[model samples]
Target: MSSLPITLSAMDTEVRVSLCPSCDRSISCTTTVFPAAEDFQPPQDHSSEAHGTDDASPLSRARRAKHQACAIKSEIARLKSLTKELKAHHRSLVELSKQQLALVAPVQQLPVELLHEIFLHACADEEIMLRTIPYTILSAMSFSRVCRTWRNIALNDSRLWTFSTIIDLSALASAYSRPRGSWIGWDEVSTFKRLVSLYLSRSGCRPLGSLNISASYNEPALKAAVDEEPKLLPPSIFKHFHRFRDISLTNSVIKWAELRVRASQESLVKSVKIVGHNEPDMSTVLFSGAAHLTSWSQYVDDFVPVNLPLSQLTRIVTGWISYIPAFTALTQCRALKRLELSLYREFTMEEDLCEPEILELPHLVSFRLCVDNPCILDDILDILDTPCLKKLKLSWAPYSGVDARLTDDFSDWEWPKDEFSRFMDETKCKLESFTLEDLCIPPGVEVELRKQLPQSTRIVVEENSGWSDEEDLDLDDLMSEISKSDSESA
Candidate 1:
C-alpha cells in the first residue's frame, strides 16, 4: 500500500505537521538545541549566484518551497473529504441504533386495543373538544398522520367523526370579494360544500351530536353569487338531517324554513335553538316533525312568530318577550319542567284587553326569570302557579336600573316580600333551592325571608354591586344570624 509520509517539526514551542515526499514513514524533528549567539550564522546572499551552480539559487529555492506548500494543501483537501465521509457514516449508525431502541419502547409495545382507548381519551380532551370551532376533526387527522396503526384506528372509529360541526357560510360570502385569480377561485364554494359532504360521510351512521350553521347574504358583495347560487350548503347535508340530535340555526332564516319543511320525521333531534333578526314570516311550523324534541331556545332582535309542538317541550329558554306573549307561550307548555324567560315589556293596553288569568305549570320543577321592570316580576308572581316548583332564580335584567339599585347601605331598596310570600303560600310547593341574583337586599329583610323558608331549603343570595365579602360591612355577622334563624326554625 502507498502511504503519504508526515513530517513533524517543533520550533519556539510551536509544532506543525506536513507531508514528506522523500520518506515512506513519518519523520519527527525537534529544535531544542540552539547555537550560541556568537557562533550564530546569518543566511547567505544567493542573489549573485548563478542558477546552474551546485548551490540552489534564491529563485529556485522559492519555487521548491511553493511546490511543498501546494502538496500540503492537496493532502489537506483529501483528509477533509475523508473526514466528511466518516461523519456521515457515524450519523447513519446512530440513527439505526435509535430505530432498534424504538422497537423495544414501552409505548410501542402497548396492545392495539389499549392504544385505541388511549387515542379516544386524547381526542376527548376538553381543550380540544370545547373550542368555539371544535378541533375534533383536526385532532383526529393529526393522530392518523402519526403512523399507520394510529391512522387505521382513527379512520375506523366513527365516534371520532360525529362531534359538533359548525358551518359558517359567511366565510363563503366574503370569498367573493377576493381579487380575481386568487387562491380561492370561483369554485371555492363548491370546494367547501364538498369538504362538508366528506366530513359528514366520515361520520358513517353515527348520530351527529350538534350542527351549528350560520349564514348571512346581507353583504352587497354576495348579491351576484346569491343570484347565481341561492344555496350555499351542499345538498348532501339534508340527507343526514335524520342523524342530527341538536340543531342551532343563526341568521339562516331561508335555510331554517327549508330545513323545517324537509326535516325527516325520524330525526333524533332533541334540542333546537334559533337566533336571528328581522326573520320573515316562517309560516312553516319549526321542528313540527321532531317528535323527540324536548328543549327549545329562541333569541331574536324582533318578535319573530314561532309555531311548534309546544305541548311536547319540557324546557324553554327565551330572550326578551312582551309579558302577554310570554304568558301565552307558557300556557301552551304544559309538560315544561324548566322555564327561563327575559321579559322586556309589561302588558300593553291592547295586549291586556281582558283580565289576566292565572298561568298554571303543574309539572314545572325549575323557573328562572329576568325582568327589565320589577313590576313585571310582581305581576308574574301574582298569576304564576307551579305546584312542583323546586328551584327558583330571579335576576334583574341589564337594562333594568341596576346602578340605581346598587347602594352602599341598601336602605333605598326593598325586595317584594309580600308578593313572594303570597306566591309561596298559594303554590304550596316546597322549594329545594332559591337564588336571588343582582339584587340589593337589606340584611334585615334577608334574615326575615330566611326565617320563612324551611331550614332544609338552600338559599343563595348574590349581590353583584362591586362589594366584596370583606367590604360588605357585617355580612359575616348577618350570615351567623341566618344560621341562628335556621336553627330556630328547625
Candidate 2:
C-alpha cells in the first residue's frame, strides 16, 4: 500500500525522533524533506526546499539572494586587482627586451675596425653614382638605421658620408624647360645641403680626396637632353668647397667667379678636367684658382683660347681644336711633362710669309698628337721646340680627300719638312719612342727624320699596335703602351 507522504517540520527535519517506533524498529530514514518537494510555492528552487533549509517565506528567500550578491561583488574586485598586476609585469618584460637587444645585435659583436671598412664599402663609388645632386638615400643612410651601435659608428666616420654632386641631364631638362614664370623647388639643393652638413660634421679633418661634378647626357638619344641641359650651374652650391685632390667636370659650363673662390681656398688640388664647356673666356681663372694643378684636360669649347697658367701644368689634354690655339697655348707651358692634343682640319699657305713663333718647352717629355689632316700636324710641329722630349705619338684620323700624302705632290699643297727638321735640330732631344699610326710614310723620309734624333728612339708604325682599323679603336694602343712606360720609369 502506498502511504500518504508526510511533511516534516523544520525542527523535526534537523532532529530525528522515533514516531513509528512501535511499527518497525529496523527502518532508518533521512532527516531532510519538505512535503516531497510539491508543497513549495515557488516553481523552481527545489534544491533549497528539498535540502531541509526551506525558505517558504518571501522574506527568507530575499535574504538568501542578498548574501549571494555580496559574494559575487567580492569576486569581481579580486579579478580586477589581478588583471592590474599582470599589466605591470608585461611592461617590465618590454624593458627587458630592449636591454637584450643591445647585447645580441650582430654589429656589436664585431670589432670597430672591420665594421668601419664595411661601412666604407656600403657607400657608393663617386663615378657610378646617379642622382647624386641631393643624396644617395639608401646607399649610405641605410646602414645607419640597423642599430644604435651602427648609427653611432656610421655617423662618426666622415669618409662614408662624402658625396659627389651629379646633375642628371634628363631631370635637368624637365626642371629647366618648364613654362615661363613657373616656380622651381629647391628639392635637389636641399638634399645637397643636408648631405654636406652630415659629411662635414662627421669627417673632422679628413680631406675629401676626389669629386666629380658632371652634366650627364646622351646627345644622340634625345634632342631635348642637349637643348635643356643648363649651359652653366649656379656657383652657390659649391661655396663651401675646400681641400680636394681631383675635381672633374664634364659636358657642362660653370661660373668663373665660383671657380676663382674654389681655387683661392684649395691650393693643393692636383688635377682638373673640364670637357665640352661653352665658355673659354674664363679658362684663365680656372688655372689661376688651382695653382698646383699638374694634370689639366681642356675641352671647354670648339675653339679654345690661350690665357691660362701653363707654368705649373705638367700634363695637358685638349679636344678637337684648330692649329692656331694649340700652337699659342703650348708656347706658355714651360713646366709641362706630358701633352696630348687633338687637331682639326686647318691649312694655310700664308704660314710661309710669317714664320710662326717657336715655343721652347725645356722640361717636356711625352707628346701625343691626334690629327685629321697632315698639313695641320706639320703646322703644329714647326713651332714647338722641346729639348727634353722623349715619348712621341702621331695618330692620323681617317678623313675624306685628306688621303693624299705629301710624298712628291706639292702641286696642290705645301709640306713643312724643313720647318719640322729645323725644330728637331734645335731641341737636340733624345727621343726614346716615336709612334705613327693610320698613314704610310716614304722609306727615305722616315729614315731621314730618324737620323735627326737620337739613335735609341724607337719608331712605331700603324701596323704594329694591334689596330686593324683606327676608327674601331679609339684607345690608340701605341700611345697607351708609351704612357705605361712613362709611368713605370717615373
Say which candidate scores most in TM-score: 1
* Candidate 1 displacement at residue 171 in angstroms: 3.1
Candidate 2 colliding pairs: 263-289
Tens digits of per-residue lDDT for model 1, 319-381: 777777777777888999999888865564345848658888999999999866555666778
Candidate 2 lDDT, 466-487, residue by residue in tens: 3443432222343466569889
Flag clash pairs in model 1: none
TM-score for each model: 0.62, 0.56
Cα RMSD of all models vs. native, in order, equals: 12.2, 18.0
What lDDT, from 0 to 1, does candidate 2 have? 0.59
TM-score of 2: 0.56
